[model samples]
Every structure is written in C-alpha cells, then in structure tokens.
Target: MFKVPPRPSTSRIPYAPLPNQGNDSGATPKASSPARSHRSSSGSCFETPVAAPSSSRRLSYAVNSGIKPSRPSSVSKGRSSIVAPAYSNLSSAKKPGEDPRPLKDKAYQADCIQNIYAFLESRGFDKPFDAGMLQLPSSKLFLKIFEFVMKQIDPRFKYGNKPEDDILDFVKGLHYPYNLSRSSLQQAGTPHTWPPLLAMLNWLVQTINFSDATSGPGTTAAQPAHLTPRRFEAGPLTNLTSETSPLDEEGCRAVFFEFMKESYNVFMNTEDETISDAKSQEMMQLFTTYFEEARQEVALDVENLKTELSRKEATLERMQDKSELKKLQEDKEILEKLLSDLIKETQRGEKDLQGYEEVLLDKQQELKKCAEITAGIQEDNALLCKRIQEQRFSKDDIEHMEEKLARRKAVLQMLKENRMHAGKEASKVEIQKVKIMEEIGQAAKKFNQRAAR
Candidate 1:
C-alpha cells in the first residue's frame, strides 16, 4: 500500500489540491464527506482529503492576482465583491492634415485663434480692406505701415523725410520682422525669445489703443496727417490671400504674430494674479507655523521657570535645616559645659565630705573617751557619798562636789548633740556625690555618641 503524507495540524493552513483533469464534467465536492474516493490512473482506489486554505494565504493570492477582498456577510449579502472593468478602449482615427492633439486641445487652440483675429480687426490693422479681408502687405508696403504705426505709438520715434532714407537702418539692431534661419529655429533655446517679443508688442498695442480712445476730438485734429488713421490700397493684401502667387509664408506669419501679440496681456495678467495668491497663502501658512512655535517656546519657558522656582525653594529648606542643626550643636555644647562643671563640683564636694567624715570620727572618739571619764567621776562621787554617810564632813566640801558634777554633765550633753549633727551632714554629702556622678555619666555617654557620629 502507498503511504500518503500526513495532514497538517489544526493551526496550520494546508495547500488546496487542483480539481481532477480526467473528469470533463465540473461538479463541486460535498462538505458532509470527510474524504472523497478516487481511482488512480492504474485503477487503484485512494482517498483524497480536501482542506480549506488559510485566510492570510487567500488574501495574499487575491493581492497577487490584483483582486480586492470582499466585505463580510453581515455587512453585505454573503457574496464575493465583483471586480471593476478597466477602461482600455482608445480612438484610432487620424486627421489627414492636422496637429495630433485631442479634440479638447484642438477646440482650445481654435478659440485662441479666433480671439487673436478679433483683436487685430478691432485695432484697424486691416483699415484699407474690409474687416473680413484681413491679410499681410508686401515688404515695401509693410515698411511704410510699420513707420506710420510706430510714429503714432511712440511720439519719440523719428522718421526720414525722403523716401530713399525711410528704409535706411531698418535692418539694424533687433528690428522687427526678425530674421529666421533654419539653424536658429531648430535650436532648443530659441523658443524662449518669442514670449518677450510678444509681451513687448502687447504693451505697445495697449498703449496705442488707450491713447487713441481717450484722445479728444481737438487732440485728434492736432495730430500729424501720417499719424492719423487712413485707408490703404488692397493690392498686396489681395495677392497674399490668393493661392496662385507663392510669397514666403513668413509674411503671413507676421500677420499672426501681430494678432497674438495684442492678445497676450489678458492671459499674462491672470497668471500673475494666480501666482501672487499662491505666494500670499504660503506666507500666511509660514506665519501661522511661526506663531505656534513661539507659543510652544513660551510654554517651555514657563515650565523651566516653575522648575527653577521649585529648586530654589528646596535649597532654601536645606539652608534652614542647616541653621537648625547649628543651633542644636550650640545647645549641646552648653549642656556639656554644665555637666563638666557639675562633675568638678562633685569631686570637690567629695573631698570636703571626706575631711568632714574625718572630723566627725575624731569627735566620736573624743566623745567615747569623755563618756568613760564621766562614768569614773560618777563612781568617785558615789564613793564620796558613802564616805559622808560613814564619817561626818564639812558643808563647804559637799557644795563644791555638786558644782563639779553639774559642769561635767553639761560638757557630755554638748558632745553627744555635735556627733548627731556631723552624722546628718555626712549622709547629705554622700547623696549629693551620687547625684553628681550620675549626671557626669550621662553627659560622658552623650559626648562619646556625638564624637562617634
């Protein structure tokens, strides 16, 4: 038996199998079946499993095939989106003799030509002939007309009195009816010269027309006869219109040049206005951006000021804390001095108490000796009383004995009271010594801790 490849797990997307080529009839597979049974070319039966492609792979395939994905069934009915048809059809016809531009471009060109012809007619270029018969004059006749037109247009232009001298210097210095060589015409840089030529003529036409229309009847009459408008013989112009004679096309091109020159001003003015509007808009946008940047900078400066203020406040607090610490140190020093003084006083008091104790002990010893003497004297007195009872004595002797006994009794009583007073003074001195020692101990402990810190 042939082993089939194991299917991928649930997370992985499987590659879809192509439909059978042997079966000409197209029928979709059933979803209810797990696998479809197929017969191989060798007539062996095998099962082929169908697996759905992943959404990501399907989207990638659609993108590669230049197809857009459809919305979900909830948004739109459960159907795949249809593709839009591309516009590929183009016209094939060609005119026999014409510029190969679109119909819209040709129409625009025609309108421009008509406007030029209208402007020429209105300016009396075809004064001698009817308005419909506008045409070019011969070179000789053209020179006369050119001189006359220039004299009317510019009051400063000087002309020759003699006929022979009229054509003199005509060919010199950027003169009109400019030379057109094949090489000059073929150069890429030559076309730029035409617009300036047209602009100059356009300015001239406007100046001339404005002077004429605004001129009073008295001013018109004062003008020279040659400058005055006049009709011309139609001989050269008639010849230009006929196809029989073969005059150079340049003469005819000159007529169109004059016509176009008059019409150029309108379009130039419109373009200038558009350009100025665009420039103004750009300036406004730049100003707005600068204002926003200025506002942002101001906000940043405010934040910096706030931070600086906070720092200053913190520094002030630290300084205050340092001053407080200095005060505490001063107080500690004062307390240490007081404790040292107390300890010195305690030492002196201990010394004084020791001297007092010695004095008190000496007094106690004296009192004991005095008490022994007093007891012996009392025994002698008792013996004297017995002797008086045995043998009668003088009254003077008895009186003297009584006086001596009273004196000894008074001395003994004073010694006993002095001993008691000394004992109380010694106990008080000891209590004061203990208190001073405790104070000194506490002060020393505090001083050591401060030194360690």
Candidate 2:
C-alpha cells in the first residue's frame, strides 16, 4: 500500500486485519469496514472470519509478542483457498511413484539414485562388512541386498543388478519417499551401492558394446531418447576359480570371504574326533551292561516257563488219579451194598433160629408134662398091686365072711327060734316063775298083811 496511495475514505471506515495478517500501520484490523473502496491490498490479503486462525486480532497479538517474524511477501486473496481439513497427524505420500496404503509406507523407503550412489562410492566400497552388522535385526536382509547388487558375466551362471533394479522400482512405485529423509542410505549397508551401481553397469556394458558396435559411422543403433532403460536379470553366486575375469574378481572375493569365515568359525568351535570316539565308547559300555541284564532276565523267564510246564503236567496227573479214584469209590459202594444184603440175610437166619428154639422149648415142656402123667399112672398101678397083695383074699374070702354073717344072723334066728321054742318052755317057765313070784309075793304080802293086820 506504500507504492499505491490509499484513499482518504479508507481511513474513515473501521478496518480489520485479515486472517493472521496485519496492516502496514501495525493496527488491529477487522472485517467491519463495510466497503473496501480503497484498501492497500496485496496477493496475500484475505478477508476471513475471527473463528479461524485467520482472526485479525490474534495476528496483531502474535506480532507484538514476537511469536513469528514479519511476512516477506504478499499473499493472493483469490488463490485456491484450502482450509486444512481436520486430520490426525500422519505421514502421507506426496510423489508420483508413491503408494497410498497405510502403515506400509513406513516399512521401506524410496530414494533417488543420485544420493545412494554418492554415499557408497565415498566408502571405497571394498571394506569387509562389519560382522556384527549381520547379527542385527534385518541384517540378513541387508546382506541379501548387497548380494543382489554384485554382478558377473559368467555364462555358466546368471548375475547382475537386475534384482536390485526390480526391487528399487518396486519401492519407488510402492512406498513413500519423503518419510525416508531421516534415514541415511548408509544404514542399508553395502546394498546402498545398488541402484547407481546397476545404472553404471548398464552404462558400462552398453558403453563398451555400444561404442564398439557403433564405432563405424554408418552403423546406426541409437534410439529415441524416450525409450525405456534396458533391463538385465540377477546372477547366481559362484566359487573362486582361475577362469574368473578381472571384472569378476570382486564377486569371487566376496563369496569366498564369506564362505571361509563361516568355515573357520565351525572349525574353531566344533567338537573333535577324539571326543566323538569317547562318546562312542561310553555308548558301547552302556549297551554291554544292558545286554547282561537282558540275558539274566531271559534266563529267569526260561526257568519260570519250565516250572510252569512241570506244574501243568502234575495237574494233569492229579486229574487222572481223581478219575481212577472215582472208579474205585464206585466199586467200593457196590461192595458195601452186597455186604449190607448179606447182613440182612444173616439177621433173618438168626430170627428163624430163635423161632425154632422157642418151638423146641414148647415141645420139651409138653413132653415133660406127659412124663409126669405117665409116672402118675405107674404109681397108680403099683398101688393097685400093693392093694391086691395086701388083700390076698379072693371071692372065697368074701363067701366065708358072708357065711359068718349068715351064721350070726342064723344064730340070731336060731336064737329067736330057740327062744320061741324056749319061750314056750320059758314062758311056761316064766309064767311059772311069775306065777311063783306072784304067788310068793301074794304070800309074803299076805303074810305081811297078815302080820300087819
């Protein structure tokens, strides 16, 4: 506004400084000036509200506090206004060959070919890599990288920077490069030499072959500059051999050095053959001890089997004996039954004998009674004989006895007769006696009466 004079009317209106911008007079400016009829304007001048960082009062305050230096140039009021959208602080890809994916952009970095080559060349590119570097996390990755960059023209094997080239292109197209600014490509180790080295190889091979091929002016092989860079494939690793060319010397050096180092490490640290022999001896001793134990166990098992077989044979014998004894028991049972039958018969015979004895006793008893009867008859006969002897008289004796009795009776009769006869006589005699007594009594009485009288 110093170059172009401002109108007097501009001073009368209430002026406001635009967002974060102050007036030349160092005064607080606001948007209350209704019209900008004559304002000291520049490309940086903008009319924004107080609600933004563009607030006019805050710009005056910040300038007085020395929070920021004075603006050097002008601002355009009409440039594309990009209000920074609300966002979490995050890194983003800003280049053409950049990836848009999240988190991955942080993993690997992309760099221009120029910077990577400069750093590697300055290191003389011949130092044996620090062995400690290989033990680090991702160290093997660096090793794989460096291994890819070394090239060879061996027909028997394929080698070149093609693999690194491919990887570089991959990173350039896929990862964001800006965030890689903090990391020195040196941190990548020997592989940092890859891209420019590859480009140099391409240039070198082409220079040799191309210069020779195009040495004659009529031969024309140059193409349009827009043609893509020539591409080559990566090569396989190899051992040191006399056939390796001067160009191949570096590659052979790297490979053998790595291999020798590893072999040397193994030799120094590994066990010797004598130790191995001792281990083998110890194993043999253990095996011998176990073999003896196994032999004893097998012998014991054989003895046990023999004893078991004998026991089984004895059991079979016992079973046979039991079968024979069962037959014997059956036979004995039959004998016992026969014996019992014989005893029953004997008992019956004895009973019969007792009955016979009783009958005999009864017969004897009857015979004894008959004998007694016979004895009694004999006695009676004897008595009769005795009686006959005693009598000794027969019928004659009876007749004599009878004649005596008759005589007695006759005598009585005789006596009676006599008495009768005598009675006549006696009667006469008694009559005579009575007559005599009566006569005598009559005489005596007569006499006595006579006397008494």
What are the TM-scores, per candidate, against the unseen true structure? 0.16, 0.15
Candidate 2 Cα errors over 4 Å, as ranges: 1-270, 322-453
Residues 87-121 of candidate 1: C-alpha lDDT, one tens digit per residue: 00000011112212222333332332343344455
CA error at residue 446 for candidate 2, angstroms:
99
Compared with the true structure, model 1 gives a TM-score of 0.16
lDDT of 1: 0.39
Model 2, span 120-172: residue lDDT tens: 33324454444333323143454343332222111122212333333333222
Give the CA lDDT, 0 to 100, for residue 322 in model 1.
Answer: 72
**Model 1 misplacement above 4 A:** 1-321, 390-453
Best by TM-score: 1
